[model samples]
Target: MWQQKKANRRMSGGAMNSGKWKEDELIQQMLRIAVPIALQFFMLACVSATDAVMLGFVDQTALSSVSLAGQIQFVLNLFVSGIAIGCGIMIAQYWGKNDPKSIEQLMPVALYANVLFGGVFTLLALLLPEQLMRIFAKDAALISGGAAYLRAVALSYLFCGISQVYLTLLKNTERVLLSSKISSVAVVLNILLNAILIFGFLGFPAMGITGAAIATVFARAVELIWAYLAVKQERTGI
Candidate 1:
């Protein structure tokens, strides 16, 4: 009650903000958006954890190497996520301005930013995987394994560069659940692929850490395609 009264007092002067707190409605709406996103994130963490478990079965060096190489993805997320979220915030501004047409135009800018930053990181991972590995590791075996993993995973960066924009836009467009579903599916696929490829299941050749990276690339590609196909009809440019 106190929080509701405080909200009313703060919102009293602004016509757009003035309202009784529809507590049940507010909670439902928040959960509808938040829960899916949280689940998607948990699924993402599962991808890495699954990789570690599977790779540990193959060799300890591989497990450590992949764990190290995965830091590059963390960095990649930092840059690409910033651009994607910025695009979402800008799109929200368009809603506030009542300028829906301009919302379409923001995509190109976000795409360009994603590609620019993502490309740079991808190139580093692809071209200097060994050198990058040396930064976090000192063991020769670890360096070699991590480098291989980085090169294999570099391609995923390209896929994510484009997919992130689509996913972010989906959330901004009130399709948060859809976006999260796509991501969750991708993560699940990544884990399944990690199993089949890492240990060479179902007649597949064992690829070890390289297979894990390849699985990530394939999962990201699927995510990119799924997101694009889901939203393509609504978008005209890029």
Candidate 2:
């Protein structure tokens, strides 16, 4: 009876160990997805930083003002970006369960919500640039330059929102590398344009700080175009 009991216990222990191993494997798989997403997020932040630096070179006041206005979007973007990833996670799980239709259905809802929010925020930012700038700075020079920068970049909110949803969807669908590549290209374009426009290099007129906002809008346009193309391809595959 003692020997039999010992054998039974050993069997139970082995089963428990196997269950733990399977959990570990699942975690590893999730990490495989999470790691790349984290890295891509970091690279995108770097792109924003580069834009800020390029703008600073054009005019410090403009940079400061834009930075303040940007903070409004940044705070709001936290929610928008969060909703995007949350939707993606749901879609991804559904896809894993072989429910591709759920992905199609969910993507549009997220996209439209962001677009609407973006439109509202863009209007507010553009219309009240000076008021927004005052929240961050008391200096007249800084306020003037910053207001100009904010007004210009505020137009990009709509484009940025639409592109963000699509990009997030692609990431959720396991198209991480492609999304990263597209963002990489946009960052390069932004940096190059900043150099040319900010300093009036390559026959471009120096538009001062306002030029940096234009460069950013141009970069965002490139990003949106790429995202649209990718969405088309994704739809075809689906």
Candidate 3:
């Protein structure tokens, strides 16, 4: 009986060890999933910081223009993020159920919703930029400069609509690292283009705040294209 009890204790110890190993593995997997998502958002925040810092070198008015103009994007992001989060929850559920076809069907719905929201904001920004700027600032320079920024960046709203949905899908589908890479590459390009186009480096014309807006537009466009390519490669199609 004592021998049998000793063997049982040994088995219990082994079980504990196995459980501990699994716990460690679970933690590692969670980190693998979380770190890239965190990094993507970090890089995204850096874009705005880069713009503020770089434009500050030009003048206070330029600095203020980009800063205030960014508010429009910020508000739109709230709506986009809400949609993306809802879609992520649904996709994760579908993935858990092993329902790929349902996910495929859902993708187009989310994409259209995002694009629709983005289009509305694009039109508003394009057609009523000065009025939109006035909602944030009363100064004439701010209204005029930020209006230019808004109009130039209006197209990016549509592009981001597409990219952000894909990115959220990527996260849900366990491809968060790729999502991070796409955002990071686009951010780097944006920062580089901001410097080049703002000051006309490498023979590029100095476009001031307009250059900053264009940089964002170009970066969002690249991000959308990259996400689309990733979707194609991964077969995450609608």
Candidate 4:
């Protein structure tokens, strides 16, 4: 009976060891996915933080104007995010079944939808910026400032919409680290350029609120470029 007891103890120990190993592996996998995604969100938040901080130094009016203008961007992101989330869900399901062809079919549809939405917003901002600003604020100074920002940032909508789709696809395909890195780099560059342009650092003219809008546009362009290159390299295996 003592020998049988000893055998059972050994069997239980082996089972526990196997279970622990699996738990460790699961934790590692979760961290691998979670950390990059968390970083990506942090970087995106930093873009707005950078804008608010730098614009604050310019003046209260500039700060308030940009903040109000940013609301439009916030609403646009909500729409884009909804589309991206839908794409991610479909892609995840298809990927589980090893259906790359289906993924290919779904992506262009999402892209078209995103671009269409982006174009509509861009036109509204570019052509009727004051009207849009009036929806958010009544002060004439705020409207004037926000209209300038909207015009400067209008082109970014198109670039940002396209890039967002690509980044979502990258994340779904397990290129989370690459997506995070691209966004981080672009945000950092934007902060740097914001300082340089907004304050006339390095002898650049102090472009003020216009400079802030330009920085965002430039950063979105950088993200789109880097995402394109990364996707191209992945496809070519180079």
Candidate 5:
């Protein structure tokens, strides 16, 4: 009976060690995925912060207008996020099954849906920016400022819609680091351009709120370009 107890103790100790090692391994894996995702979200948040800070320095109207104008974007993102999440689910499943072809099939469908949604918003912003702004604010000055911002930012919706699909696919395909890098670069560039264009630094004209919109569009374009190149290089059919 004593020998049996000693043997059982040894077995329990070994099992405990194995469980501990697995727990540590799982934590490390979680960090690897979580850190890059966290950083990406942080950088995206900074884009809005940059816009608010630079525009606030210009005037309260500009700041308020952009903030209200951003409501449309916030709504648009909700739809885009839904599409991305759906694509991610399929991609994750296919990836686990090692079925690249299935992922390719789903990619185009997601891209088309996202682009269509983005196009609708772009048209609304371009054609009836003032009306759209009026939906959010009754003040004429606020509506006028928001109209300018919306018109300037309209094209960015198309770019963001396309690029974000690619980013989502890349993340699910185990290219999280690459996607994070691309987003980080775009955010940094947007902030720098916001400073330059909004205040007319480096001999550029001070465009104020319009400049903020231009900066956002340009940064989104950069993201799209980078995503395109990465896709082509990888031949991932994205």
Candidate 6:
């Protein structure tokens, strides 16, 4: 009986190892999963560069406004990203346990929590954008423009929160490639829309500070749609 149990254990281990034996295949899979993610993050970072370039071309005020607004958004993002990391930990542990239902159950609570926290944060940004700007000791043009820009893009926390949570869910589910694709699509949409809206190209209204807000909202929407589609396709199923 002892020998039989040992043989069973060895066979089980061999079966597991056999399925994972193709080192090249594993490497390819890792690259497929990792490259897109790296690219997506790079793309997101590029958006900031793009924003600075385009706004600077418009005028110094446009550049300053967007830059200041970005500062407030950045601080809020730190908190939201922290929450996302915690959610990731929860999702990863549950996923390892093969509990999709738990993931589904936990996601809404996490999302709603982000929403609640983000909403309050947005309120503070809206109500006291100028005060926050003054704290930065920016020049007059930047302080006023930044205040205006923050007011215009005040919903940033909500938009970012929604996008961040969904992406985190995908990551924990091991759908990193798909998540990256979604992010890439959103970045493209954002850049295109920014050009059109900011420049009034094709007769679109040149919204200026408001244009940046619109682009952000549109990009988040695209990201959310792609994430939902991925979830519907069961790509994240273990």
Model 5, 17: alpha-carbon shift in Å?
A: 1.7
Q: Is candidate 5 or candidate 6 better by lDDT?
A: 5
What range of 10 consecutive residues in model 6 has the weakest lDDT sum?
229-238
Q: Encode model 5's per-residue lDDT on 1-238: one tens digit a residue.
A: 9999999999999999999999999999888878999999999898888788889899999999999999999999998999988998899899889999999999999999999999999999999999999999999999999999999999999888888889888888888899899999999999999999999999999999999999999999999999878877887755
Model 2 worst lDDT run, 10 consecutive residues: 229-238
Query: What is candidate 1's lDDT per residue for 4-91, written digit by digit as tens?
Result: 9988977775644434346667888899989999999899989878988899999899999999888888888999988988888987
Q: What stretches of model 5 exceed 4 Å from their correct place?
A: 1-8
TM-score of each: 0.88, 0.82, 0.98, 0.93, 0.95, 0.82
lDDT of 3 at 102: 95
Residue-wise lDDT of candidate 4 within 90-126, one digit each (tens)? 8878877888788888888988999998999999999
**Which portions of model 1 miss their true places by more than 4 Å?**
1-21, 96-98, 236-238
- How large an RMSD does model 4 have? 2.1
| Model 6 RMSD vs true structure | 5.5
Candidates by TM-score, descending order: 3, 5, 4, 1, 6, 2
Q: What's the CA RMSD of model 3 in angstroms?
A: 0.9
Clashing pairs in 6: none
For all candidates in order, the CA lDDT equals: 0.88, 0.79, 0.92, 0.89, 0.93, 0.81
Clashing residue pairs, candidate 5?
A: none
Models ranked on lDDT: 5, 3, 4, 1, 6, 2
What is the per-residue lDDT of model 3 for residues 35-100, given as tens digits with 9 covering 90 to 100?
988888898889888898889888999999889988999999998999999999999999889898
Instruction: Please provide, for model 2 over 82-185, each residue's C-alpha lDDT reduced to its tens digit, 9 standing for 90 to 100.
Output: 87778778877987888878777887888888888888878877898888878878898878887888788886788888888878777777887777777778
Clashing residue pairs in candidate 3 (N, C-alpha, C atoms within 3 angstroms): none
lDDT of 3 at 12: 100
- Among residues 3 or more apart in sequence or in different chains, the pairs in candidate 1 whose N, CA or C atoms overlap within 3 Å are none
> How many backbone clashes can be found in candidate 2?
1
